[model samples]
Target: MKHWRGAVALTISSALVTGPAVQVRANPTAVPAVAVCVASVGCVVTVVAIAGVTYWVLSNNGQELRIPVLSYTPTPDQQLEDWEDYVWADNEQQARRKCNLLAEQYTNQGGSLVTVVRVRRASQRGSRWACTFRG
Candidate 1:
């Protein structure tokens, strides 16, 4: 009788453990309504934030840049009158140095034009002088 009782208890416990753990049900219509309300609120907040940012940006706009007035006339300091005139100095180092100096001289003499103009010789003789400007 004791062995029969133990076997019955084991069978009951095994049945309980193997039973369905989750209760499945049909989808509710109210869930969609709640999601729509939350989504609408989110959209409204997003629009208000965008409008506020745009207003702030427009209200605090920066000053416009004015054209620089040059105090001194622009002039080339170094002159090369040979085949090397057509070739640019080996790297950018020389060109940058010249540009900085030219820009300084221009700003010093009330010259509003703070620009550097590079003049290069053409491949052929009497060709129009090739020029480039940097600011």
Candidate 2:
């Protein structure tokens, strides 16, 4: 009786371990549907994430215009101090509009005599050059 029980257990365990192997051997080209679907979804998500990052890196989304302002001091010995204001916009016109808004805000806040020296547009590769304000 003991030998018979051991033989039965061995047969069941071997069948359980080799069942999938036998099926693969019978039809080697058959792929499971669930694996294919999961793989396809993973690939799609990866491709979309890569494309979005590439677009953001290659585009001029975060480009800014640097406006240099010379502030005059109201003291016995008047001094002129220079500062920069950065505005992010799509183009030069939009940047000028934003700069005008900033100038209004600054003037309303009791700021000193501020005069804009020039507008500098920063390139995507970090170089900056003078850009004319059309506003």
Candidate 3:
């Protein structure tokens, strides 16, 4: 009886010492949903902003004019909400030539011309722009 008890104790000890193990299987298509979600949110926000601005411009201006909207992706070094005009040509002749016709039309209407030239360099980051005029 004592021998039998000793054998049972040894078996239990060995089982306890070995411990239980778990295996985790990897999912092959486990792409992080965070980026997708954030991008979707950004797109929605961009659309809403564009729509709201369009409505405001139409309501405020007696004459509706064409407005250009530019959109691009951001670079790694840039923060999410950071936005700025990255380039402009200071050459007076070139600037005037490029914007000459528009300036003339607005000036003819007894409104002063305000020229805003903005340029952005190569980037993989995301951004958007809208331009409108009212007097």
**What is candidate 3's local distance difference test score?**
0.27
Please report how far candidate 2 places residue 24 from its true position, in Å.
92
Clashes of 2: 0
lDDT, ranked from best to worst = 2, 1, 3
As a TM-score, model 2 comes out at 0.33
Cα lDDT for residue 65, candidate 3: 25
Q: Locate the minimum summed-lDDT window of 10 residues in model 2.
A: 1-10
Candidate 1 vs 2: which has more lDDT: 2
Model 2 lDDT, residue 90, Cα: 68
Residue-wise C-alpha lDDT for candidate 2, range 96-132, written one tens digit per residue: 6666666666656745545455666767744343433
Candidate 2 residue runs with Cα over 4 Å from true position = 1-77, 125-135
What value of lDDT does candidate 2 attain over all alpha carbons?
0.34
Local distance difference test, each candidate = 0.29, 0.34, 0.27
Error of 2 at 57 (Å): 45
Top candidate when judged by lDDT against the true structure? 2
Ranking by TM-score: 2, 1, 3
Q: Write the per-residue lDDT of candidate 1 for residues 57-129, one digit (tens) a residue.
A: 0111232212111112224552212111222343355545554565666457744445445655444554333
Model 3 ranges with Cα > 4 A deviation: 1-96, 119-135
> Candidate 1 versus the native: TM-score?
0.21
